[model samples]
Target: MFRVVTPKNDQEFEKYFAFRWQYLRQPWNFPPGSEKDEYEQVAEHRMIVNSEGEVVACGRVHMNTAEEAQIRHIAVHSAYHRRGLGQMMLGALEAVARDQGAIRAVTNSREISIPFFSSCGFVIEREAPTELGLLKRQQMVKKLTDLSSLVLHPKWCTELQKTWSETIPITEHMGIKLHQYTGKTLETRASLNKNINVHGTMFAGSIFSLATLTGWGMIFLQLKEKQLEGDIVLGDGDIHYHKPITMRPRAKCNIESLSGKFSILESNKKCKITLQVNILDDDTPVAEFKGVYWILPGKEASDAKRT
Candidate 1:
């Protein structure tokens, strides 16, 4: 629900405190700087915005030592409290720590906040101090452990099984799961009649999503064969229709050219490739497609104990 943390530069520092009086020094009447400690300069501040572009929540973090990190000054606007904004903020901070080689992450929670952090996978070890006068805090921690095997990379057979398991509306939707890749070639027959015509042809939108997904299936096949671990997401695309299908439509794709479109990926973190699938009616070309799709990098881990 929130974007990545952006460290505030000269242009963005003034927006941190929203109703600092209500959240920080409201009840006990503590001094102004008690809530905001010395971490502002060195630590990273992440802000969350609602659709209206108002900053509703904010968090600050700093690397405490060589092997540990700490989170400080995590606050959400009163109207937005109890929404798990704090938990999400910590999760984002934890990811930053993990990527930076931290072995452990810690946070000191106010008395009312101990239960919240505990539910976010932290364990309290002892009581500590707080900015508000005469308040006892809880010492909480979340350990950083190896997460390599939590990902699952599926194969041809495994993918088909997954598709079946996740498919829906068994009575209305029909799928022919191919056993393996057959060189980007797919031939499916669809009933067509003159009554299906707007301009004496099949509806264009039906052919669009179908043929686009046909090329998508081809990439799915190649990824299955390569055993490369990643998720395929459609970043963007463009489609062009060439002719009309007045009769049955047979479809085929040339993945070699499509594969060449991805050659740029070897040096880049992401790639966008255009694919063409010719829709033919009994050997007569009815429509042609020029579709572009964005491919992002993704990896997921499976459950360790369950597997």
Candidate 2:
């Protein structure tokens, strides 16, 4: 097994820089010290180490402004490709950025790595300057904030939990419960023991259900925060399972990923919104879910259809 860590002592720092140089600088024929920058003293660094104490991946993040952070020096050992260590390292760097009050993160990624960064919730904003006047790069950005236009209240979370238990009886049986809500982000979790499959991992169907409700809950809170009445339903959804979950399953939905118009609901018209939910195994993204939700006019309209 591999673990993510921060280099503290002199020996660990030596190994960390050497690993960064090997994958990031050496391949481009750059000198040894080219792997590091002046921000080393102010930036946050993370690396993944194998059981044998070898560093397989490393990255760094530094605040460029009070609300903006820049990620740099991302490198993963060739032998450790496709193991999700890159995402794990990015997660650690972003966490540090958030703690330091950064609301967004930016990175200059090579053309070959744009797709990998996109899968981690980054979008290309524009073309960045070439590296060493050779490799073309793209400027990518990702939001790190949980704040939205609507203010969140603790009582809203309580009401959402009650609605789930009373309306969807299956949520209780599946062990789904609201884990947290930070106004713009809603986090929920399900018990692995209750939803485990024959393969000894979280059932695919259970993961879908967990992610579905988490997205639904975010929309539900948004409407409640705006004091708008509506009947929300899952119009459609797609989930990509990157890895199995042997531990308890948790899903997080952010308002930053939300797009669409909710104003039409005030005119008694249906509206649609799309959002994403990330299923995590202790800060590592294990699955990604994008969902389209529809909000019908009001509770009366929903009740009329059933009648």
Candidate 3:
């Protein structure tokens, strides 16, 4: 549970000002009592608080007619700095700007804060003055276009969730029904090996299959959502049993990040994509598999998509 706060009253707004005084002004030795000015009247201030009811981070934005705005007074308590609360607050400000019809959001960042802004996908535009005597502040902005990639239509995500739930148990029972199990990319499992004396280790085959399945699931779902249909298949795969696995298995696929190449199938044609699977023990990767998938096309893929 997380809450993004925008101070709408005198007390919270003053707390907003105090945050800069405590984290920025006091440490940087800025001109006394001049750290914050009359901007609170027109600016939209945001804060994030912990469950203990203490404000841990704050930021302010002056909405200058939706299309453009300036962000200011960003600060986080020393104890809570690295937890990304400040970044989260900035995200909220960007949302508000969008709600106000802004197609882009901008910020003026201090030198120390430039890397942080860059990591968040902002581009530097110009330099400006700061309270600490002509500090070369950087101006940056990010267009709201990327926002569209995030909207999931809810129904599609829910369907994907259901597919994951259904597939896990089926894959776990794979060898029980068919001696040959298949998968997509990275996978990790515990004690799928017949050699129990190996101290609870998983078999390479099982781990490989699980990873392939996971990647196949993601690609299958994503393509289906786009109205793209195919028989997504694992034509060939390789496994590298890195070290040993002694815990219950978990797995993942890496199509989203890997560049490589893949193809889509239609009708009865065969199209393929390579899937890399990683098997892990309690979140630490232990074994791996690379799976080559062939899209079988038509009914098989479409039926799976519907399910």
Candidate 4:
């Protein structure tokens, strides 16, 4: 297995920079230190290492503004091509940008690498200056705060968002929106300004509500994907607040944290599933919510049962 990590010591950094220089600069006849820049001291750097401790990929990200980040020096060894090391390194770098409160990320991609960056949710915004005044590049941009590009079932996610806004008017007022649903994970976000308390942070009740809706949306998406129908309701729930969220609040629910089966709903009128949702401020989890959801037969299923 390949693990993504930061350079924690001199030896690890040596390997990381060497790999970056070898893959990104050596072929271009660039100087030995041309692989790095002035941002090295402030940027977040990540390297993908194989099980044997060999660095195979490396990348860096640095904040350009409070809401923008620049990604640089993305390089993966030729032997690691098609193995997803590049994507893994990019993801780690993006996470660092998000953790630093960046809402968007930009990268300069060589012509040959444009497709790879596009596949990872970046779009060409404009032409970028040639690298070392020789290699042509394109400027690509992606919204890190809005994960809609990662949605596997965009139609279902949109339907769920519409249903929430129309059925629960409060959600609209809370600025709740479904951000992403990748079949296995659901992410939802709420505006802090819309849900903030007098203490200048997100209200506890709003946090709980965000988590509840996130978990509910996960079950909704799962059932929809499986061609099942249900009336999802929160049966029980508890929240543990670890910190106050001063920024926008986001809730994430993963399938791995869910327990129970949806197939049971086909045989019986009801099924129960427990799931966990984490509320995050930036990249730090500020609160955790555990909820038990009861899925009862939907109108069509109930009509069939009655018949």
Candidate 5:
């Protein structure tokens, strides 16, 4: 397995800088110090180390706006290329940007690396000047959280939003909105001002609520994708607060882990699954939610029996 983290000591950072130079600059005949740029000090950086404690990959991201961040200097050691280390480092950097309240990520990718970047969900926005002796670059961007493309149907999206607003009146008050339902993951956002407490930060209760609903929505979307109908409910759950959320908080739940639980439903007509939801602020995990959810085939189906 690979471990990713920000370099905390001089030795680790030296290795990180060396790895970048080896992969990105040295091959192009650039000097040693050319791997870094003006953003190093202010940017969020991530280093991935192998089991031997050698830094294998590195990348950096810095805020361009409250809702946007730019990624730069992504490099992976030649020895580890094509092994997915670069994508892992990119994901870590994107997570950092998302926790920082950025809803989008931008990067200028070298032409040789375009396919790799595309595999990680970045799309070319425009082509720009070739730099450092004909290294072609393309301006690319990835939406951190947006529903327009993910939502399968406009009417369904509208109805889901309406249902949440009416059934859970507090959702409307807190300005909670469904951001996307990509079948694999479900995401929602809540306005900071509406959910803020006397401390002028997101309330713990609001965070829990958002996480709970996001998890439930994941199952709901999965049912729709399979052309199946189900009533989803949270049976038991817990939330952990790790950091304070200062901006509009986003909650996301990945349903892949529950694939086995869904298979059980096909055989038994109902299944209970456990899912985890995460709340992010600025690229850091502020809260975590673990929940047990029950799904039944129809309104008339009995509540799921614990097994």
Candidate 6:
């Protein structure tokens, strides 16, 4: 269980501020008070406390414009790395940004942290030069809302959830949840408790299933967008386990490669399209899945039934 909280009082704020300084500033030999700045009073601060009541992660988000916010001082105790606490804090900060009507969240991420930020839906805007020119940093941005308004209806996502829960019993057993689906991306998540292995990491099979279903979900929405009814099935698939997922498992499918496949299906009645899905633990890829899917149009299915 992780708790994201804003320091409710001075005592909590001290712990939160101290954690940030210890992990981020002290290691760099920055002065004691360097961890804080003038923005402390205006920025929204958040931290994650372990069940033991120790602050393990901290970050801040400040609105830079009516539609944009900047995230800074994202730090997690080294002992808490890879546990998804940083990602949890990011989500909390992004939630604050959204509530403030900000459409975009920007941050200057350390080079080592780029993958984590990317996994959280941030894209690299540019690389910035540091003071010493020895270390690399990046300007990253994450879209807080569907600015293009390409989100599908809630009914479709709800129905898709029902279809998986009922038709795929293991999806229900794994506790899979639909996180989001936009114009070209489909995201899903599974609880670690339901899918954990003896090694205390997420089971590989669960990761593959999440990836496969995310790709299928993308095709499902694609069919709806084209106003075509089809039966989508996995024709074949290959998965590479990059690392053991120790946190909540999430999968994403981006559809840039999905373009023009519809033309093949329109001409052939059935088409096999390949999609790549990534399983990430807070933007770190734990597994990669490439699945070839077969989409059979309604007319093609009826014709086969008559044969």
> lDDT of each prediction vs. the true structure?
0.56, 0.83, 0.60, 0.83, 0.76, 0.78
Give the number of colliding residue pairs in candidate 3. Answer: 21
TM-score of each: 0.47, 0.53, 0.48, 0.62, 0.64, 0.54
Model 1 misplaced regions, further than 4 Å = 19-22, 146-307
lDDT of 2 by residue, 8-62 (tens): 8899999999999998888889999988778999988888777688899999999
Backbone N/Cα/C clashes per model: 5, 0, 21, 0, 9, 1
What is the Å distance of residue 229 in model 5 from its true position? 2.5
TM-score of 2: 0.53
Q: Model 2 misses residue 173 by how many Å?
A: 1.2
What's the lDDT for residue 57 in model 5?
A: 84
Candidate 5 residue-wise lDDT, 110-178, digit = tens: 878889878767899998677665688999998988544334454666777887887778888888888
> Rank by TM-score, descending?
5, 4, 6, 2, 3, 1
Model 4 deviation from the true structure expressed as Cα RMSD, one decimal place: 6.7
lDDT of 4 by residue, 1-307 (tens): 4555678789988898898889889999998899888899988888876659888888999999999999999988888787656666676687678778988999999999999989888999999999888999999999986646446567888899999998878899999998655465577889999998889999899998899989989999988988988888889999999999997688877665789988988886688999998788855568889999989886644764577
From the highest lDDT down, the ranking of the candidates is: 4, 2, 6, 5, 3, 1
Please identify which of the two predictions, 1 or 4, would achieve the higher TM-score against the true structure.
4
* 304: Cα error in model 2, Å: 5.0
What is the C-alpha lDDT profile of model 6 across 1-307, one tens digit per residue? 3455678788988898888889887887887787888888889988876658788899999999999999998998888786656666776687678768999989988888899888777899998666234446889987877632213466788788898888888888988887766555566889899998899998788888888888888888877777677778888889998789987687877654453367666665787778788787754557778889888876886776578
- lDDT of candidate model 1 versus the reference: 0.56
Off by over 4 Å in 6: 1-151, 302-307
Over the stretch 72-172, how does candidate 3's per-residue lDDT look in tens digits?
77787788666656656666566556656777778878889989878766889877655567566888887755632122233554454466557556453
